[model samples]
Target chain A: MTLATPPVGEPRHRRGSPRGTGAFDRSRRRLYLPFVVPALVLYLAFVIGPTLAALWISFHRWDGVSDMRWNGLDNYSALFDDPTFRTALANTLIILVVAGAAIFAISFVLTMIVREMRGRSFIRSVLFFPHIVSAIVLSIVWGFIFEHNGTVNTILSTVFGTEPIPWLNADNLFLMILIGTVWISTGLYVTIILAAVDRIPRYFYEEALLAGANAYQRLRFVTLPLSWDVISVAAIFWTISSLKIFEFIYAFGGTTNDMPPPAVWNSALFVYGESFGGRSPSYLFGYASASAILMLVLFTALIVVLRRLLRRDSIEF
Target chain B: MQMRYRRRRVRAAALTLTVTLGLFGAACSADDSGGGSAQQFTYWSMWQEKEPQAKVLAKALADFEKESGIKVKVEWQGRDNVTKLLAALRTDDVPDLIDQQYFTVSNAIVKNDQFKDLSDVHDMEIPGESKTVRQVIPEKYDQFTTTANGAQFLIPYEVIGYSIWYDAKTLPDVADNPPKTWQEFADVLARSKASGRNPIALDGDIAGYAEFWTATALSRTLGPGGFYKLVSDKQASGWNNPGVRNALAAIASLAKQKYFIPGYDSSKFPAIQTKWAQNQADFLYMGSWAPTETGTLAAPGFKYRSFNFPTFGSDESLPASVIGFAVPKSADHAEAAQKFIAHFLHKERLSKISSEANNLTPRSDVEVPEQLEDVNELLQEKKLSKITDGVLGDFSDFDKKVFQPLNLQLMTGKITPDEFIDQITTGQRDFWAGHRS
Candidate 1:
């Protein structure tokens, strides 16, 4: 029952070590800084530089074209009072938590069922297909399914004798979007969990069965623990990706070329709507930036907490 | 080994710093070279290249190039030209001419002072016509040309009037005898429903479409100035105006009676418009562009005609908007851009825009396409009014907070008439309070 554990806190390279004397290790060390510095420079210029600029912009009043005026904390204070920003913030959290939980739970169940099936590869591929399709296309198709007099309504009326539902109305739109996000995201998580599950040694499951453990017990003791690290990583991925969901929701506005109703807007949509969206772009760059920076700070804190909650001692194999 | 590793790290850091500095240097020096003998200008158009307006503009540009010996580079940036034009204004590279809807220019770009004053163009004679630019374009279209600061910033190129459209084939009798009063309109809807036809097809997915009904109703009930008081004046009592409640209630009753096509609330955009074109509904309230925008989706031989939105007692103005073009302040070839504008507005050229493009040209002398003959009649009769003119320049916030949300709720039957008024009044008060500080 012994699990192989790699040294957690040990440095890869120690001065005068026997391993460091190897030619490959020495050459790899020599090339490491050269290879990493290029990408690091780009990352700083494009990602970090703009982020810092946004932070600076958040403290000023700007319309993208006008000379920026220092507004101190006024923009930040205004965001708290903005009803649209509050709705966007609430929507972002719901997608991150509710949609994330649904995606992982569904993926895990599907992965468990498909692992031992005869056509497991086909089923896995079929489930994984949505991950590759552009989210805008998926959103359009999803809208059609739930649209009044759409596929869902037609089926309900002819087969079940039920009335059509207002699936895309203001009160119900965000809920429908949450469900659509879960449906689109589950496949990718299932594929990742399945890969992790496949890596677990077959002998561990066999031993669990030999000890008279039931199917659920085997999954609980062996499979779950073995895939814990991957699951935690997936959780972090979902958090970051969920905060950036824009195109799918933006498409929901249809041919109108206007921003979606504030009730359904997430933080990303809020940034655009405030700054450069709407039929006539608002150009409230400072206000938009304040909300954006606030969301980033909140998201960063959530990610750190998630990592701590999901942390566990890793088994090498 | 430690010394060698430190030396390698230092070398890598130096190399990376040098490369980064070199990249910045290259970016700084990348400027357009400037010695062309030929007269050249760059134009960014808001219309897609294949759209009828763009096609006619392209023909006009070609004619201008041939006659004037100007090499014009045209970029079809489509609906995003306003944002692109704004960005371009901040940089050295800019388009000599940009086309945008009049509302966008007045409310977004011109408000920000991005466009050059084109008042001189108003006095310039058309290239091949006897009239000056201002003489050919009717005075009603002047609302779109003038900015908040009283400067003429853009030229109105197309005339767009908002009204109720009906397919002659679907409701032949109604098309011939359009509703002219609130009660008549209501009775028409009821009769249409009783005859097994959906009275209206609304693209409710976009809240703007739903807001149109409220805007028209309010303008009719309150008169244009009173409607402006309700939306733009930011006075809380504007919402308390009995006319405001009645207008909202009128629209709400349509939803209450299910006069709109079933499932309109959940229908995808253009889907409801397509349904209207297919004659699934007997009527659609839309802009003058409705015929052209939905023409392809129309049932075969579906002839479309539009009439002014029927008035409530004492209200008679038809809601109108305009689409047009402008030159940016940063333009390098402003003179050439003006020349191009004058050429495009020539009587023959405008006639082509009307005939070939199936659009309502702003020039009063140009004969409109047969499809828009009804709309032209309204214009000729001087029955048009700016539907949302009251809030046009400074109502973006109120639009988002009050108009858009409550309109959707009212149309979807989520709120009563009283609740709608209460929410809007409270919302407007809070919005103004926040801005006042």
Candidate 2:
């Protein structure tokens, strides 16, 4: 009927065509690759392009208002010796290790509880609500809370009779920032992990149960392996985000207004303060650009390493 | 299950807001009274505050609208006042009148050449207000109003002063008065600490609060004009200068003194308002602006007064850094704006501003509001109410460059006075060289 279907072993498409489909397959190409160009353009313009420009600017010094001077790694050289920069780097690492670990572990446990819930959607929204609010707005709100005579201390003094702690001190500045960040962002991860947990079929659990596998055994064998890919992706995201932690810290603590947030100046706040924290020198925006470049490098390295550890064979379940 | 699930997405938020169209409609009543020249001029104020000062100004505008037959439509944009003026400068359609930050007068001149020199206008105005303008403003503020090219930028709007604000109730039974000298001041604070009260309730997050106390105190010690030269000169930015080092060391010594309220740098500025409100701390060295409602300093039963900050070095030569406002050159309704400027300085309007929350008016015609104790005392000096550091005139970019960094260094204990002066000089030299090119 169709010339015997081009024989059993014959190709369905031309050699160069994907899935053996020809280039003339207009409708199929239109349906599939329509999304590709837009996504590519978005990634190029916003992500890849700005990154390269930031890298270029990092070598020079320019205040946002003035002309640029190509310092040729002078900013980088200065950054290495700069106490503020060192503090920021250490702070970023501490946040990544602490918040990253906590967010993931908590998300897993919460997902386990939430997955078996009756009001699953309601619980999911509650967890994810903070993620919808902008970090800057949230930080401002938190600032009111942690402010010297804020509500937190008012309650503490009234209820437990504790004195107000130096919540925004150099010693605990990063900790307050971390606590705020964790509260706002962990919900998104929990939701992601929950979705992954949902996709694992009940059949696997039933089969495991018949095999006399307990809840812990069923979870380890069925849930953990199935959700490993999603959990790994979440970790990679948290790593990148932790490296560029700016809005919360920047809004939470101002260098002029607040003690430079325990000198744990994430590179974002570091460059920002250098550019315009009231005492900025002649607009060496070039140097700010340079710090941005270095941050990109650091973030890229983190992503690469995480990919190596979390990288795995695409599961065939 | 499906019905229950569907209801979650369709639910309304908790707070139910009534539209109240009737109330809103009543609030939008139009005024049509006219007495004189029906000049419909547009005006703008930088502050969108709900304070009575704004309301009084609005009433005056309405009165002016009734008297002059000039309906002033004001578009108020609220945010950082100076930043808004800078944005207003880059456009052609600007309001006829503007109320902007006092420091912006310099940039206003450089950005646009459209401003009608108020001095020229001052000379042209009727003889009645001229004497008032001349008498109220000191020579220093006159210098500030003059442009780089030497023209009056704008009339004085408001004057601010800063000093140590103390809870009068918390004064120990032993100490009779606020300290007059740096050592006495330190001792008084130590006494306060010994008495189980925070000696200083400075903000935790701001470096400026600390800098203000130490700098003002040091200026009192360092011959009257010493700190003024530091602000105007460029070489003093390095932490190497002796005075710069002295200032930082002084502040650092205070920081280490343990008499400062705990969490000094981490506490937000307004939170200090509460600390003082709750009588948790004794002294707050803040702006004269604090007496205003905008500072939110006045809580119910709020009792406080200002004293001259205890001095380390005397500075008779420089005035306290005061903030004011000016309309920029790109103003659309320049004549109406001029009228508004004049209105702001008029005796009744100025008095209203001064009386409301006890704000200071630079107009010599008006007496100091009774609520402000410091200015009332300073008014007694009558040694020409000198404006802040640039009252004589604004400095070039280089001049600002020279001192800004040194000021930071001085605050941080990172540099000495000699180094600070040297940096100022170097910064000035660099700025001068750049200008020459």
Q: Per-candidate TM vs. native?
A: 0.93, 0.72
Q: How well does candidate 2 match the true structure in TM-score terms?
A: 0.72
Against the true structure, what is model 1's DockQ? 0.40
- Write the residue-wise lDDT of candidate 1 on B70-131 in tens digits: 87989998898888777767777778888777777666567668778998998999877787
Model 2, A98-197: lDDT tens per residue?
Answer: 8888887788788878888899999999999989989888888888788656788778889999988657655566788888878988999998989998
DockQ measured for candidate 2: 0.18
How many backbone clashes can be found in candidate 1? Answer: 0
Supply the TM-score of chain A against the true chain A for every candidate structure. Answer: 0.92, 0.82
Q: After superposition, how far is residue B139 of candidate 1 from its true place, in Å?
A: 1.7
Over B1-437, each residue of candidate 2 has an lDDT whose tens digit, in order, gives 67544433333211111123334434544322221343666556655657565776777777777765657887555433344444444445445666644445444343345455666445434223544455555655654466666777667666666666665545533225656666777787787788788877766566445545545544554544455665544343533556656655666566556666765656766666557656777777776766563235444555566666555554433234434445555554566666655555667766776776366766555667545766546533533222323312234233223333345444434565555556556655555443311
Q: What's the DockQ for every one of the candidates? A: 0.40, 0.18
